[model samples]
Target: MQLFNSRLLRERMQRFSFPAGGEFKKKINVIAKWQKSLRDSDLSKTKEISIQGLFLSKFFGEVLGYTTQADGKKEWNLTQHPGNDIDARIPDGSLGFYSSDKSATKAVIELKDAMTSLDRRQSARRENFTPIEQSYLYATKYDGCNWIIVSNIREIRLYNKSKTQSYYESFNVLQLEEDEQFKRFYFLMSKDNLLGDGALSPLDELLQTSEAQEKSISGDFYSAYRELRLKLFKHLRENNVGYDSSILLEKAQKLLDRVVFILFCEDKGLLPREILKRAFERGVSSFLDSDQRVWLEMKGLFKAIDRGNDKVSPPINGYDGGLFAYDGLLDSLRIGDAIWKEIVELAGYDFESDLNVNILGHIFEQSISDLEQLRSEFDGLELHTSRANRKKQGIFYTPENITHYIVENTLGRYLEEHPDRLPVIRILDPACGSGAFLNQAHTYLQKAWKSAYEQGEIKSKDARYGTLFDYNPAENDRTILLNNLYGVDLNEESVEITKLSLWLKTARSDEPLENLDRNVRCGDSLVQSREIAGEKAFEYRKEFGKVFEEGGFDIVIGNPPYVRQELLSPELKEYCSLNFETYSGVADLYVYFIEKGLALLREGGYLSFIVSNKFLRANYGKKLTGYIQKNYTLVELMDFGDLQVFEDATTYPCIITIKKTIPEGPMTFKYLRLETLEVADLRAELEEKGYEVTITPDSGGWS
Candidate 1:
């Protein structure tokens, strides 16, 4: 099982043995000391800076020098007072430094050792700060200096203050180390990685220590606490559990009753700790808040503590033995069976052990002969689910038809001929919403695994391919699924749902199982950094590894998000320009994600995306088309022309597929021309079961 490190907040609470007030005080002190050091520093001179300049420096790091201007050249204007007399002034050593020649204040420099949290926020939230709002105030208050540069004691940023338009354009010089005999103040800002190691702060170390302790709470204790709390709350609402401290007595009575019943039936004893951990891991406490935790603890105390002796029972559950043993025992009981059934039904899976067949959606309907109870269970879910948006439906599945066609036309042909070679395929969906594309690809590979297992090419199925029934896939085949399917998305909720979707779909046709942190994960595909945990949490993956040198994904497929040009956040637009080499038409965020996805794949990785048709017909889309024409080989264009691909979605969407490395010739592209939203015949379909059909245009065409 994969263990996630405890977060900073939890760690602090654990170590402090209370709350965050004291720790926050310490953080404030540290900030003060850092600020004082900058004020006292002898290396540079300071001047009164505009609030906007201070905020900008705090955010983007202090500017050392301009690329175009000479040292100590103040070319820009930060003066709020229009006719203020500008002249030489002494540096105050807080906001930034003035030039030595002092002709025009070209740069602002603020010193620092480590970056503060507020430093980065300054770059983006320009309109929110108080000081920056009064750039004119700074100009009238002090003479000279148009810019401000603040450093995290390492990295420096240069901001050109443009208060008239209300923003600052800034750049980072990365890491700037302390030096002597510098040619000019600006030269010091030229280097990157100012300090070695970039070690974590003392506070960070303390936080990590606290996190280690929180996860150590035993399962039995947790479970007992939870049950008592839930019962107490239910009682409080219904007036049953009682109003006094005897709520504990009530919970104890309930547990004792269960114990009596169980003891009567069998010789086994119950451990509460093991039960609680299992519940947490299965997302049982997902909605529980701090109040609920306190209630549970209080209720557990009243029920479990021996009143006269004033002592709680010794916890019987151990992490591996007692905890897991309890889980195994529970799994055999009616309660466990019911819970597992619910999870299975929610994921929309169906598999037949006798026929060795697996179906994608609506599992219980075909598997179980009795449907009355299950139908009622589904009805309850509808009421619960009505509040959620489409992203929650688990219905935004990648149409399998598109997958089969893309894989066959690109990777399949090669795999079919080779036969013996394991397809060293690496597929990525930059905006892999709910792992739809990966799920489809994973299913295809599972079929391949079953085929290999049947052929007796391998032995011993991995836990991933294990089932409750007789069906199993070869170990090698399971590895194929594990290795080939990887996706990244920014939505935390979507990432969890997507992981569950992939896990449910990929499980052996007849099984109940679990996996800890596989290929699916939460992340911004564009802003991935090496600092982030998780294998798929790639920071700039397009720039490194086999994918960069050899090319990226073998099959890329998904419905990338369509963010409007007017709606693009300034930070997002700027981010795209800084990272992506080629982009089109303030082209949608989806377009940028697709371009990044394509570039990350191997030479011939096929990309199929359900994109907005605006790129096909809109004026901005023209530039996007021109870009695709120049870079990619348009292999298949399934244009869902005039289709309401999205009912609730505002954008008129289309599906297009292209290969990264297409051979020279008139490429054969398929066009799916839709006439209406309801017409099944109008939808295109590939030759695969459960794959939907839509209206399609001719297959062979020139770009």
Candidate 2:
């Protein structure tokens, strides 16, 4: 319970109203007596079942307000999940919903002795699920159940779970004497709220408020992030001399990237908790200046990250990737007291729990976008993620849902199509921004291989096989970056962030990070061979010789950058015309990505991209559409007309999944036109409501 599973639960706990007035004091007095009895007595030595009787039942009946059987017991009939096979009895108790005597039990409750932790396995088996996990499984499957209560007689926790999300709140019994602790526990679990009318209750109202609050809180991460980014920039700007503003921004970007990498590592336990903070504290304990402490610590920790710490008894291996490679500028700079302190604080932010991968990717993308803006306006007061800015640039970040959907339709299907347990396939994201699509693809592959191995579907333990991409607690970051995934981004920092993210995702304590320079490259994907306007080209045949030799990648996917047709440079347009038959003079920058992505795919290889839907009817999109229709198999087309799938942006986007195979008959494809306005559960919506349609790609304006 110390680790919050979701932002909704965090918000709910923070905002739960503390009960007040005279009546609340009386309830507190009763709770105090129970607390004293449990602690003052020898209740800690008894069996866990004793908790169901002694003080817990009384607390539930008198304070929380749940109905009990005639014998003062709660119901406990629950079936064990197949995967959670263990010799354990049904749940300890099932409480009536909304205090309704007529209704069946709709909430499951588990009890444990004061000595047992909530995470203790109920059975002696090592594979047995923990009590909290067991409770969640049973609660989700139990007829009509929406909530679960787990307690070790010393602390109580409530969980609300759905298929894709989980939320919960925990309160300690020892803190009951305090008004804030007691009130939140009482109000949220009290019979008056849980057993309220079938209509909206206090809990329901709180759910609504928390949902809105979650969005606001998410925005707060960026606000805090922007502040951190700007502060670091200002510090570097002040410290560095004889350098252009763009160089200052680049230095700032590098500094922030390292901080973000370490924060993520700390979150995942690859590094010690408060590593930077400890460094800062070490400076304080040594009576060093603020300017000296942060730089000294950050440099040391980063060095250790690059080269393992061998000073300790059990040496921790240093990461091998070029992320922490020597930077002459950073080495020479010394941050002042105020900026360094602020940075240490920001570094301590809980990146794992609060900023999930998708949000983290957005933070990176938006940070880079904003940082690029800062490059032009070094002294400008404003950084823009404004919708107007996005509209003008035709820029929209591909949300996780869209990325997951595209990956599934493309990469997921590719796996299913091949019966071999683990196929020798590589995935490429030609226009990879923050590597969101590549990250998702890698995650899917990891799970698929892990599940297969667990189910005994794969027998070989080959290092170069499934074991490479699969999670090997010891293998760490090296395997995932070997050859399975590839990325190409124009921005060098984007390439750096992509590697950092993948490394962080697969990082383990004391493991060396892999070098992914060849796998995830940085160059102009549109200009493959010769330079176009002095831009370095990521030539597929020369760069990925083996991939091209074996036809091409098994799957190519990404949300290519969107620049309006008018913005394409003259040289870029010339390159596209010379190299791509699908190119058009008025087509946007993304059009070239689609063409290049497909070109990188072998026959029957899958391709998916979520780009602007203007291509459906825009005059410039005719050649691209016709080329797709004539040369490839159109698998799916999801047209989200006018509905902004992004969080706070205005744009029309469509996901098109294609296969690099010549079509023989009618071009049939799965078609989905979003009918709903909400972005939640998009995969579910597409599956339940999407239908199929035939298309003539040669015709004008495919729509």
Candidate 3:
């Protein structure tokens, strides 16, 4: 625990030796044979059990020098639960040491075949790339264990338990082919190192070094994003002049979204790395000399991205989701060369890693200095102030924990019940502000579809895109984004961000982005009739006739926006009164969203929304409560009473999940009230609480 250097630890590990070097040498030759066989055979035919025997057991037993027995008694637990008081659930295998003449588990070992990837970004990873988020869960759950060793046969990685995810070390199998790589791998991971010559193991020394480095580093993606945003805002405000406030704001927002996405593409390898950075540097000189536009470098790339392979200097594939579409006003606008220098400098930092899309779409934080200053500078325009715009429009940020909960219970339940429906299932987020719900849903289905593909449950013909023989789960991630995920936002910019977020989430290099404008639309989701809202009217049967004809969506779920009754226009109130019998008078804006969302649900379909808890007790909610009582089957409900779920606002909220089927018996549903605002295994917590509610016509006050 005292001051330790990774260099000194490595030198010590090099001196430590195993007595069974002959066995290790024989295992190395066997590994080469297995590697050749893997290359020769179809990876699809490779069995995980075979991999466990062929690669995993030998490598761990020989190279890493972990023993299976102690005192002639077996000391390794295999193919069963850890058998601990905490987290008794079974994992693939466990690495252990001898203690009390029995195997004492050290780390949960998960072995994967060639099928799944160790890549963190790919959907093919199925969100199982460990030591990131899942490791934290394992750290606490795996009894007193603090480590997990995971491998996909091709590579092996080691992660230590932490309250938060810390970076880990990965030793690829290819490392065994080279002396230096093998030495490094053996030094850190060998059983001799774990049982060090000194008081602490080398891995323990490395952990201390990493933890210190982690503590020294600070600041998050939002801060970095805000800094970059400030620079852009200042440049836009000072330099641009030919347009009105709205146009100017639109140009600024669009340019920022596109640039961030392009930067993301560069990091993802979807576009050539440094395509923008190099071009920006090259264009600085060309800008003052050229007779064409001022920022010609980006314009050319934008055009090439829009037109597919038609134009290619920096070599970009088409990404036409309205993000790269010709924005004449935005493209033509020129900024001082100095701004581009700052942009090129900041572009070196990875935005995709830093800027998460969950809170990225529109600037929602009212406390941000840039937004507060922009509000003052814009005077009364309300251009850059998205919080005001969002409040007025009745949209808010939905947390991923919330989204994951709702999506799992709703879409997750549906998928579990009908696994065959993966190819044809439909999900929608009517008020998908920045595509949080849609993104969650996309990820959920991506994992399901990928698992099904790996298990041979999904046939070649079931592929969403490409030929039968060429069915790829990676490409299907895009097809699923295009086909399965659907959303509607009143804000045009929000709709664009939704599309951009989805594109960024699943975009493949040089692959055409399926135009998603038709899928995720921009309109007032509550307004249906033309006479009521005219151009903004989003009639379900008319605008989404295909969805209607297909018996509406299979699941409709999201965090419907929070807007008070007073914000409703008289016309909107009247329209609501005439159209919906759910909530009488000018109810909270979320009430109308509920009625519309449930109405759009296919029979036996599910609809869930986390909205104001006031509807359960307030006099205004009588109509809605009665309507749902008589018309739908309540599945589950959670009163997040007094528990502050949203960071931006203090509101009493409840999550309600409904099945679009009229009740056949007394109103009974699983329900609970959270005492604390912590994100954990919600389903397990609900079951552990063991609470339910029943209501009848003669029911009295329950609280």
Candidate 4:
């Protein structure tokens, strides 16, 4: 039977109008009444099952326009075991819609109680035990069934069994009352939309394409960088350049990164686009076919970028000489006609077309990883063996999801609490390998500034410490970038990459990056030269003195290096143990970083880090844990116990958030034990529960 008459359905939708402000309130009032009655019913667990059937099933069926079985006959047998009893594993209900000639089963849906939510642990309870998996199993068992849905009244998820990932879409039913969200809901579940393509709806196709585009951009950028690196390395080797392989790799990467930034600037309209392209083309032309000419042409281009707007070339505002000032860098770098042509071709790709700062950052990350791998092979070390060495140094980039969660909780929460301090808020990532945290913070601040401007909460003059003037979003972004966002890394290459990434994040088509070194620096953060009281100590102090003299950073965040004491140099290990109260004989370098981050925060400021969860119970962590308890307010802890947040990594990681001030009384903090990486859902659950526990100095260890 046809569940919905197409003609009538179309007419109904055409006549329907969304509710206005009062009308929307009225709808919510009606839902509130139903909720009150349901609570007053005092239903048991068994009775709640009936509510899922009587209310949820019927409501969704009517809304989505699906025909349901009336006699309670199972539409498909999913499990291998055969049983007729309801308790012996039966699908919730089967849905059918009219195809061209006849009614056909379109999807199978499984429902759970409104209070129950699906998580990875529940899914892994048994093979195909979760609602989504159960529906998937049924789809595989039955012909012509391609859609599977799992809902618990509160949240709904749809899956296409034929797809590799299977996951299609998910939405909270409670959110359907919102106008925009309601539109999304209707597009995904409307009878017309679903029946048009049972396997993948139009909305699904759009989402899939967006995801694919992001991946494509990242992949293409990496491919271009890889090609340039290989060609440049081959050219240098052929020319018998005396630099070691490590030095060669570093120089090549630096040159490649600079070229990419110039290309990006060109695409964003900051530079004359065709000027660099044409210059390279002329260098490789048959008339100037000598490899030496290519080097000279490239050197001229670099000189033009550094000097900006000379007598011969137009002024490129905001161009800095720091990035291009290496002694003999241009003189030593020479490329053949073929390599020059290939590099130019790679540069021709559009860098400003829907390319985001985060994606660009990931491209750099992958490029850096590849460079390290190549360096390891050049050193005669096995690839995997070299990777393990790097991991020990805590060189891995933080995954985007974890970074997003940490930033939202720490920096996002801080800004929310103190809106007036937006312009002056200083954020620092001391061990900022490639500046992932810094870049994310810069993006977040820009968005926050724009939002405040739109709301008329900020003005141009108001940004001048205390005065209120006309609001300019672009100026506000520039201010945020220049005044805020600080980072330091021991690796000079990482420091440069961080600056480049941050510059890329805030680059405007009309402006050039004039002074990126003001905020990001290269230094060892933990030990100051003065504190060491030796010849080496003075050098350390000179490097870090200015960073500390600025009244410390207002906010500090990073995934600090995880080297153990055994891996550290004798001098460094002795210094850390003597300087940091948290440092013990066997403490890891990350522990000292935690101490340093805390010391750097201003009074009442915040610090957050993702490090080994071993601090909770390890013997070496006792001093650190005690220091935190006595000095700061523990804001939140998310322990991903044995959950591999980083694929193939051995350590059990946890996120720690703390405020710089001491607690006046019993302090309650949010704690989570995550078994999977469904961070969005985990965050929702945490918010709903508001889990808090009071810890005191008298209380025993965290275990």
Candidate 5:
């Protein structure tokens, strides 16, 4: 019944040695009386006005260091008051803090009646006018306001206005008074924290703490994935399967990826919850001493998952079969019941609760070691080592931050200027190894569609934009994903993995997957067979004819392979020399991808690539540089000189954004010198001096 437990408040007061002055002490005592009055009231409801007057006013004035007029002692006062609609109709109340040179409203407070909880979802009728929405609206309107507080006496939510979404932190007032560790929460909303330009200091601290917590969580998740894979491999080996050590390793890696996907599906409610647990229990009882029987049962389950429920004896309605196409391999392999049980138990973690696809992608990335590391460990084993070698040959995956930045400035900015094209804009990743850029593009499209939907810009659920926001794959999500995202990779396995990753991204309960082959192809992007072999020769154009015939894509982005000239096959080397104007004897392979990507872009289409920075200064880059200056409008150039973008690698990476259009005059290219590895620092610098440099490309070089 107490507003805050009296003893806990007293302890906090003494521990922090908070102002024990006469007026503050009296104000605190008065707050306790108001709590008693609210608690003892016979009325079924307490209005918002009473809550504001009795509790919020005293708390802000005395505890949080805000000026207030004394009861029966004040004349006309000009100082701002923490009350409802203080210069804004949206927020319930706002507080203004002043400095010597400036005075501005620093925070907005949204209050509800004692009976109303701010955390609960409102009824459909009132959903649009929820407290959280109101707080966000007010914060957005006020240029100086950086904080939003929503409270219903019992629970309090604090949001940082600077975030994309203003939902940041929350707390229980009573719990804060009781726990000493919770005292840090005060730093977020304290008067001292809001002074001058230091308001965001506390938010920065919170971000650091949150980042540390995330890293710890990611480490744990990685360890779990690693342990599970090793155990699964050991079990398979013990069973004496026909495959040799090398084959076993490859199969083991694929099986581990499938198991992870299965776990993810279950967590996301695509599969029945605890389905793995039940399967394990049943196997233990039915196949008690028979390892072969357990393996057979597991094989059947995989087959069912692959063919989906419609084709199986006992259908699992929602699954798509491509991921489990290697069911024959599973049937041949024998796994012990105990091993099955351990794996099932491991999959039972609540992955869907806090983990998103982005985080899961990171976890999956850590599950497998690079080819070079793996080859060193398994000596004399003839593993499928070409993929690993390719990775080492500068086919590194792009980091999410870099991907997002490029996509935002290119496709994102394009869409903003041409809103009507959101539904039809086509995106391509020519050398999509694992579909990182494509996945990011899909995510961006989803967000854009969601925003459009919320703003009532799009009306029908059947609209092309609807596919982006549809969570259920049976709906339009899969269609939108397939129609919008196109990719090509040289490695077939990489193509399959890219398809799988994209499927995982848009997967929902009970949705059948459309054939992804049409969108994601496997071929060498640079050289067509006809170009090398003459008429009737093999060509990638025949495979990806649809995109080629359509006059190219609306957006093309990727981190292309960076093989050296010496590493290129004789046919490819000759083909590049004959066809590409930018080809030089010492030019790296990525240079060709750049020319290919440009060729595949329609006029005014955007193209972005994170490739070797050597093209900026190398002797062989003169042709490429000249070609770019003559043909494309260079939108941005982010040079990471000597800063390694890939982990444990030593290549200087640069991100270049260009539009497939000619420039009329000296174009101001947004250039950033990446002095640090941190993306945040780069972003901050980009905001300040990104457009400081300008250049016009002549036939020779940049001027």
Candidate 6:
């Protein structure tokens, strides 16, 4: 079980480099000139300003070829310390950049020092898309190229308005005299070519003697194999190396062969022919010759065959078409249309919209009981705890009432309008702990589809069952899951829980559950900031092929994570800054998801989500609002009104629904201002008001 040691591998990678000598100095001079202009102006360093003038000057200089004037002085004049004691001032010497070209200037950049790293700046950078946002203003006022660069000395990155691309370009300086190790880091930062070609890379570092690799491989073969696979994938990605599909498949075959050869040789002593024949009956026959078979069989003579019916064998059964071999594999794979159908059914919203209030409302109440039991079960589990208190410390389930409201209010109107059509929806819950949203969504679709099927308005089909639950048992099931939903999160455990919830919702109670690996995946959605790479969640988009070749989703919906500013990882934050091109500042991970959801949708598609009420009025939310106002028709907005939707929530929550393409507005959506909601009335209330609702917080006004 060989695995690449990332720390050591990174050290190895840093040994290679290409220098940036005089070219680096010229860039620095441009920074100096910009800095001079800022120093000559009225703006000075305060603990209160939110803009970093000197860094902005330098960044703008580089982005626009040293062309921006210090016209931002007036905007910079008003300065007050953040009352919350958060770092509010646009500090002196902060680095920033902007593009003025219409296509490129649509993007924005902000730099920060101290509390502001490339990561922190990115949050603010990802959400702001205003015509005169600090980043946009800088770009517009500076009037230059269509990209912006913002950085502190340790890291530098860019924002491209033209392509809506943002990403960190360099981790460290690219000086000629920098240490060799540092140069390797520079190479990684400066050139995407330093990484591999294509997207897939194979694992081959299994023989490394390093401690990390050894630590990862010291477990059982299966455990070691899994770890090694992850390492292999990570190594290729970190180095930016890519390989072809044929290469990846070939590598997989070779690795499996090596495993079989080693296991057989050790088990049979000398690889005896008779033993090989038995093993071959299970599929090993396809890979070995007579000599290898004989060798493998000979080893079996010395091997201990300790027997219990439950003791797993290398190949549990011979290839019998009547039994659990191929069928099991197919079942596990859940390949193609079979899998797709399941997902679409699970994600069905059309029925939910058409259902009368009494029936759907009753179903939601029953779900709440199930959720409470789930919460109790998880609360008893032993796991790492991040926050204090017992109830809030474990896997959080969305209150059933809230889930019902989210589904109906956010999606009901659109679904009602197109009852004849199954709206192809794409939704993601960035921190989908226990998969409350996906589960609720699955139920929403299932109930709707079932009703239609019962009424004979739609014909539904049954799924085929397989005898064996083997390697590909989930293959067909996977396809079913893919059709309905897609999600990404950094929490592996949460992903697992999400899959289980989705499976439970889709499976028939009387039949043995289909052994399906779900469409839900584990990843940092913001990490891919620029390119999605080989992650399965992203793969779904490519696998479908239609969206990439034709267009994107018809609808995007979900509840994104609510990670506080201080809790985020630096790498994740940096990646967000470099990749997410919309707004920046206390970015709220949910904000990026909204931006991504919007991007993944087709022009006329709808976008919906429930987020912090703060964003509705926060300065950070302004650019996002502006972008939505300019590009989308605000179909509806619902303020749940000071309701503690989360058991642990300290802030008010708001739900917003909009369509991607707005046709010449002065559009007035329905508006609802409610004091509080009973768990039972959520669906009815939202439905009665219809799609044209505007709900405003007590403190903020809405037009």
Best model per TM-score: 3
TM-score of each: 0.41, 0.72, 0.75, 0.68, 0.69, 0.41
lDDT of 6 by residue, 1-703 (tens): 0122334545555554433477656655554554443456432333223444444444433422233425543222111112222322221221122234322122234444322333211223222211112332344333332334444433455433221121123333324224553443333322132212222111112112343343333323333333343333333233333444233322322233223332333332322223333433433343554323422432232132211112334322111111111222212211122221222221122111122122222233222223333334342422233233323322233554566556544444444444443324444455565566665555555434533433344443322222222222233233335654655555544554455445434332122233324445676554543344345234435434554454666556666665554555566567667766655647666777777777777666677777766666777777666666666777767786687766555546677777777637355565565556542334334434435534332323353
Can you write out model 2's per-residue Cα lDDT over 397-488, one digit (the tens) per residue? 77665776677566656765653524467889987877888888776666555545434555665554435334353442244467678998
Steric clashes per prediction: 46, 3, 0, 12, 4, 81
Model 5: how far residue 124 lies from native, Å: 34
- How would you order the candidates by lDDT, starting with the best? 2, 3, 4, 5, 6, 1
Count of clashing pairs, candidate 1: 46
Off by over 4 Å in 3: 1-242, 287-294, 308-314, 332-336, 352-377, 380-395, 460-470, 529-534, 690-703
1 against 5, candidate with superior lDDT = 5
TM-score of predicted model 2? 0.72
Q: Write the per-residue lDDT of candidate 5 for residues 1-703, one digit (tens) a residue.
A: 1112223334444555334468545644654554555467632166665556545555565556555444333321113334442233456666664444545666778887656545332343121234554565566566666667787765567665544221255665545543342444454455554442455544445444555555666677766666666667666776865567655656666776677677877777776666566666666668355655555666666766766665533347546646677656655676666776657666745566434566666554433333234435554433343445645455665677677667666775577556767666778888887777887787767756655654456564545445343333244465456567888876554676677777778776666655687888777677667555444232545665675666768899988877767777777777789989998878999998899888888787899999988888889988888788778888878888898788656678898888988988876677777777643223334644465556665434432
Considering lDDT, which of the candidate structures 4 and 5 is the better prediction for this target?
Answer: 4
Model 3 accuracy (lDDT, Cα): 0.65
Among residues 3 or more apart in sequence or in different chains, the pairs in candidate 2 whose N, CA or C atoms overlap within 3 Å are: 98-195, 308-317, 308-318
Task: TM-score winner between 2 and 5, please give it.
Answer: 2
Instruction: Tell me the tens digit of each residue's lDDT in model 4 across 525-591.
Output: 7766654433323232244455456565678898888776788877788887778898788888889
Error of 3 at 200 (Å): 13
For residues 1-703, could you state the per-residue lDDT of candidate 3 as single tens digits?
1122344455565676633477656756766665666567664357555556545456766556665643254454332333332233344566555544655555666655666543222222222222133333443444545566667777677766531121356676755756666666776667765544444566666667644643332134445555666667667766776556555656666776777787878876788787778777677657366533236776877777776764455567887767788877776676666666666665765544333343343332221224434445564433353455446545556655577678877876676565656666779988776777887787777656655654556565644434342247677776677567789877666677777778777777767676887789888898877787778788767877777887989899987778889988888888888888875775798988898898998898899999998888888777777778889988898888978777556668988999999998788888888886653445444554648888775564222
Indicate the worst ten consecutive residues by lDDT in candidate 2: 76-85
Which model scores highest in lDDT?
2
Off by more than 4 A, model 2? 1-217, 284-294, 313-317, 379-394, 421-423, 461-477, 529-535, 647-649, 696-703
10 residues in a row with least lDDT, candidate 3: 119-128
